[model samples]
Target: MNIPLNRHSPTPIYLQIRNYLSRLIQSGKMLSGQKLPSIRVLSTSIQVNKLTVIEAYSLLEADGLIHARQGSGYFVNPKTTVTSGLTLRSNFSPSQEVIISQGGGSFFEQYTTSIQARRQQNIIEFSSGFPSTSISDNLQRVAKRALAKAGDTLFREDFPQGQLLLRQLIAQMLIQQGLEVSSEEIIITSGSQQALSLAMQYYLRKDDWVIVETPTYHGALGILKNLQAKVIGIPMTAEGINLELLEQYLKSHRPKLIYTISTLHNPTGITTSLAHRQALITLARQYECFILEDNAYEGLKFQPVPPPIKALDRYDLVTYISTFSKTLMPGLRIGYMVVTGEHHQPLVKQKLLNDLHVSTVSQVIVSEFLASGHYRRHLNRLRISNLQSRNVMLQALESYFPDAIAWTIPKGGLFLWTHLPNHLPIQTICSEALSHNVLIASGAAFFLGQGYPAMRLNFCHTPEDIEHGIKIIGRLIKNYLTPSFISVGLSSQEVSVSSMR
Candidate 1:
């Protein structure tokens, strides 16, 4: 594998090596179990410092891409394949055909396939609503510091509700946002996804109706469908979820729960206004229903974040869920929920059965980080970075894509929802783009039951990478729309374009 050495470039030499090696491994050019050149040999070949090669190799090893031996060089591990695939086996029956008539089982398959396929490719992933790796370093450092101070005591089982310190920290955090939450009200879970799952388990019964946004987070959609809940989707507008339609659903179908992302809504990057929040809260109270507010993207906001729906909730019906995944780190998987009114006990019980509690070490570390002033400083840095990246992606999109493709300019959050012209087949475009070496998430995965012709592009993960990837996408779209190009099959060069696009 040849890695271009750019001494004049501002990028660190090690990162250049890391990126080159990562690309090679991802493209299957460097097979699993293949040994990378020795650090000395690499340093000699590249004419860089030996320590630079060592640093790059170490970084790659830490990322789970390769393993080091005492006497031998680094070798790619077999686990890389599974890690790259990101496929998890579900306990549910695999034979359940994913047909539309089969009650959304097939829809789950499409979601899983999109995620797994993206993981397998080397594309700059704007499809996932996850934080960039730079944010994770702070969390990791916090965890390490906690371990150094606490030692082996952290290995023991923690309180069923999670560490008290973390709970208190979470409570204080919520209070600052104008919610009068207590430590007892917060229940720690694996992540926001688990928090949502716990809420579903506590409230949803099979075939019970639930109201969700028309195109929502796929994971939430999957969980609700897995629970066998009859989901009624209210179409989202620039203002957020249509309150009138939501009320109509409440009146007509009497949904038990209304799951929403009010603050910096996912996939579409639209936040519900204060008026809409109050309206939804009032409607929930009027209908005597629960509002599961997923505020996962709350902290990632570039603009002043709006008050959460829970803050406006007076009836004790809003179950507020948020996580450090987007703001801090996704891998930490630390999420908390605030349950109000009479639902606290049952929800806590459901959480206990699901995973007993979130990791105690994670809780303590994150809590300590919050108390240390580190979290605040890190958040400041993240906000600036996110804002810059968001601007970069927006400019790239506007410059590269066709005028027919419309997108929302989100105030904050990782995603930008783009809609193709009505006649354009998103799946076909995605498939055709894949053949050209550019990968994009099809819009259909975001829908609850049927697919749509829109795609959610995450803009904050890698701005420069997104720029290059979108250029490929623009080129591919242009080719697809051209009648002359349609007559000829895609070539190998076109496939490369698709993969990167």
Candidate 2:
């Protein structure tokens, strides 16, 4: 029980004690079911107050590392998993520590859980990352037909590279969009998130530099965080990521990869141009860095756009990823990535290690959907419906929101990135909106530092829900702007709600 205590350190004494014991227990130095010293004995031995020792023990107990019995002293929890080691060893160097709000879980996980919790509640949910469109009957019939066709094959394990049929269909679909990719170059993943995770895991080492768009997909940020990569957020422009600033970063920092969502980008519906895509590939070649292009929302575009960055890549510098989750249905969990050149086989191996490929049933169904042309028909209907939903949300924002707020009008996509005056309490507005049963994503989770004064609103809700949710959010923002609204510390009810619909 030899513990070193740094009295001069900024960390509190109790936390230090807890952390020390946690490391010991997790490292298996202190075996499960081992009894800890009595609080009085440890306090006297360590020359700390008994209360401090009690607090340390209490914290450990809270974390399920230790438990107490009525007659016995605390014993290590037998089922405690070795998670403390993972928490302590971070990718961040002392100088490059990311100060974003990664307090509990990453925002992506938190928002996903939040969406799930609020599913049955009579609430206007703008927090969802998935599209709000319902599954078409055509898709159901396609699924049934797929089952009939697949029969016993669905019970068998497919190749780690994915079912050849689905990959071929995806490749054909991409070729129509002007990207020349072979089925062998593609690896199926659980979703684009899995593809993103695989690429990051494959290319990144701790403290290895990786660049992403500021206010980018929080899920990607979460993956980068887990990998302990040094993330550099390049500011995004209306046309896409700022290439000039990106080149500056590439010149100074030799990042292993640059991640971007070039078309119908999440949270902001901005799409990159053909010239921008070409120039980006050129920059990647010059910098000797790879590009991870997340084209998840490409199929949901309201209008025609440039081919993917991978299409413009002549040097095999780009690894492109997309998913049926966004276009068809998230439950499908079918996504694939195209890796050309030397990285393809390695990534195929990585995919083999990543859940042994996506679900066989999902792949078969999606393949059938694609083969029957139902996916294209579904996308056409979804694009139109999504556009109308976006229009409804925009109209609601314009009609009810305060003049201090501004938002983007995405041509296609599920989100509307709304910026408030920096002085406004963005977090407070979000909380109040939630109190009124309106869920919105805080902009802070998307950045490297204290996030911007902005929020991401999903337009995938029904037109009625969109209008109602925006009206409520608009009113909340208006309350913040009022000169007479001085009760920042007051409860949610006191802030404003008498006029809420």
Alpha-carbon RMSD, each predicted model: 16.3, 27.4
Among these predicted structures, which one has the highest TM-score?
A: 2
Q: What's each prediction's TM-score? A: 0.73, 0.75
TM-score of 1: 0.73
Model 1 deviation from the true structure expressed as Cα RMSD, one decimal place = 16.3
lDDT of 2 by residue, 283-368 (tens): 99999999999989888776668899898888888899999888887888998999999999999888888687678889999999
- Pairs clashing within candidate 2: none
For model 1, residues 30-127, the per-residue Cα lDDT tens digits are 88889999988889888889989977875565344666655776787553112223212211110111112112343466556556756654656656
Top model by lDDT, which number?
2
Count clashing residue pairs in model 2. Answer: 0
The models' CA-based lDDT, in order, is 0.71, 0.76
